[model samples]
Target chain A: MHYPNGKKNDQTQKTLANVSKSHAFSNRGMTLEEDINAANAFYRDTGKASIHKKPTPIQVVNVHYPKRSAAVITEGYFKQPSTTDYNGIYHGRHIDFEAKETKNKTRFPLANIHEHQIRHMKSIINHGGICFLIIRFSAHGETFYMPAETLFRYWDDQINGGKKSIRYETIANEGHIVPFHYQARVHYLAIIDKLYF
Target chain B: MHYPNGKKNDQTQKTLANVSKSHAFSNRGMTLEEDINAANAFYRDTGKASIHKKPTPIQVVNVHYPKRSAAVITEGYFKQPSTTDYNGIYHGRHIDFEAKETKNKTRFPLANIHEHQIRHMKSIINHGGICFLIIRFSAHGETFYMPAETLFRYWDDQINGGKKSIRYETIANEGHIVPFHYQARVHYLAIIDKLYF
Candidate 1:
């Protein structure tokens, strides 16, 4: 960020307001999650897709129910998610995918993705659900939709002592680029339309 | 019933531990959630389907990341889920549902089903996803599968000066019973198979 994380952000926001909304959005430095959430909201509002992000899995060990207020989780631990973070029905097909952002422009390290998650994605694909990954290269501001099949290849190669990451060039050539827009920051359904519909 | 307080609690915990290890679907007193989870586990293990219960939505306010342990959610509140609790794919179709158990023998109350959840179900059905509710009458020990389409009729009726609950007899007559099995305790997919496949 050009300025400190404070009133400077709002000050710059106003200056950027004079520019295009999309241009402002990129300069504002919204995370990939924020962009995808905005895209999901747009898709939902337009009746294009019924996609949603599944809640972070938390194992609640204890809860305190106050007299009139909501129940408060006193002791809880985040659990490893067995499935991808997002899924829904799109065009009568079961759509499932996990999204991640990497600052490294050279490659995406596979350490963040767990083995059980890979198994879950494989199961989804085996059951005829559409599964993929949305990888955003933060340094390059490029997001690519890599199918689970393609990811499995790299994952298996990694398991067998291959390179630990998927090269950015390989993804750029093999994966579909998710377009960005003012309303849908990551208009990924456009890529899905071309690939599936 | 005759045991003392502390001993009874320990015995109960031990019984639960044993029940979990042994696939004892014949065992009594399993909650609707446990039954549904067992059914989902069976489905996943057998490669029959890939359904899963979505994690309870929690709004985490504060977290404590200790030096050696995993992050602990120190302050969090339960969130009202906009969508149903469980959803996945079966037979190449998206399956979405909310499951509940009622001890009341006369009827199932409408207070628990939120308006937004009903709207989400409608959208899921509109998008060609298989949507439904799994209602279990704990007193009667009978579980029924009620389609979202049918549930909407009752929901709309209740919205417009109708009864606040669905009569148990009405459900027994119109809804499909979800058979209990040794492995898949709920065995709800059986009803889906008969209805769709």
Candidate 2:
């Protein structure tokens, strides 16, 4: 059997390279994820939106509370989320969405998204809620607002033997490029105003 | 010093009774809360609205996995919600609301609500989302859908020297009674159709 040049009898070195590549960033300062988070916090604090990041769920088996006021978590296990990253009410509307950042400059791989999230989004849209993904391509320093409707179409097409992944060209053509700002760095609400309101 | 009904202490039985009374229900069957939850699950399975109760947030301090698949939580503390009871998307719109059942036959006390929740709902409204409250007066087996806009107005009026709580009369006058159905037990979407669509 033939293998790539990077692969050898010892696969550890190639695996390490792949892991590091995924983790490393060329962006100099704060990441797009951090900026969006800050913007959400600002929006919430100012009573503009009530959106929030769901706290990571954990299962606890033991705790040490030495004093009345202090409780220390001694053991725990993380759990998968049934919903998306953020959910709350905006403009008296139920708002639910997930945010993802990818380093790939050519195409946004479908593998990055889990099947559960797609199913969850389908349910959201069916029930008449606005659902979408905030995709940030860090390599190009660009963000796109891909509505759940568009995503659903692409998702269904894949099942019928279409493109297996969403190319950057397709995203640029179909998705709204979310312009950044000083206060609302992601400026998602701006896109929402145009699309929803 | 004199006390009402022969109770002299500040943290008297009367005070405690008042606190617990807000959460009390006369029905002895499966709790209304539980029934509503089951109904929501049934609705989801049938391609109805996607509504869910936010999992009770717990600050876990310890966890133990005795076996590979069996994990146990040993210690945790409850966390207060910054939002409302129920939130989701329904019918291409944002649905954000709270479900609160009150036993009082005459009035819905202001004490049943938290300040932060009121503030959160206000933000949801400012953004153009559909925000309201599902108030169930279990005594009469009646539920009312009160818009957050109306609730906020009453809340502000109370703060600015109006009635301390919403009278059952006012709720009857201003709120729509959510009709019960076999499938969508809550039937809140029907109310939304009448009010919004």
TM-score of the second chain in each model? 0.86, 0.80
TM-scores, one per candidate? 0.87, 0.69
Docking quality class, candidate 1? acceptable
The C-alpha stretches of model 1 lying farther than 4 A from their native spots are: A1-28, B1-27
Error of 2 at A100 (Å): 1.4
What residue pairs are clashing in model 1?
none
lDDT of 1 by residue, A52-150 (tens): 999988866567777755677776668788889999999999999999988787999999699999999999999999999999887887889999999
Write model 2 residue lDDT over A138-161, tens digit each, in one string. 898888999988887888888788
Using DockQ, give the best candidate's number. 1
Each model's lDDT comes to 0.85, 0.73
Question: Tens-digit lDDT track for model 2 on B14-54?
Answer: 54455346555734333456546766777678876777767
Write down the C-alpha DockQ for each prediction. 0.39, 0.16
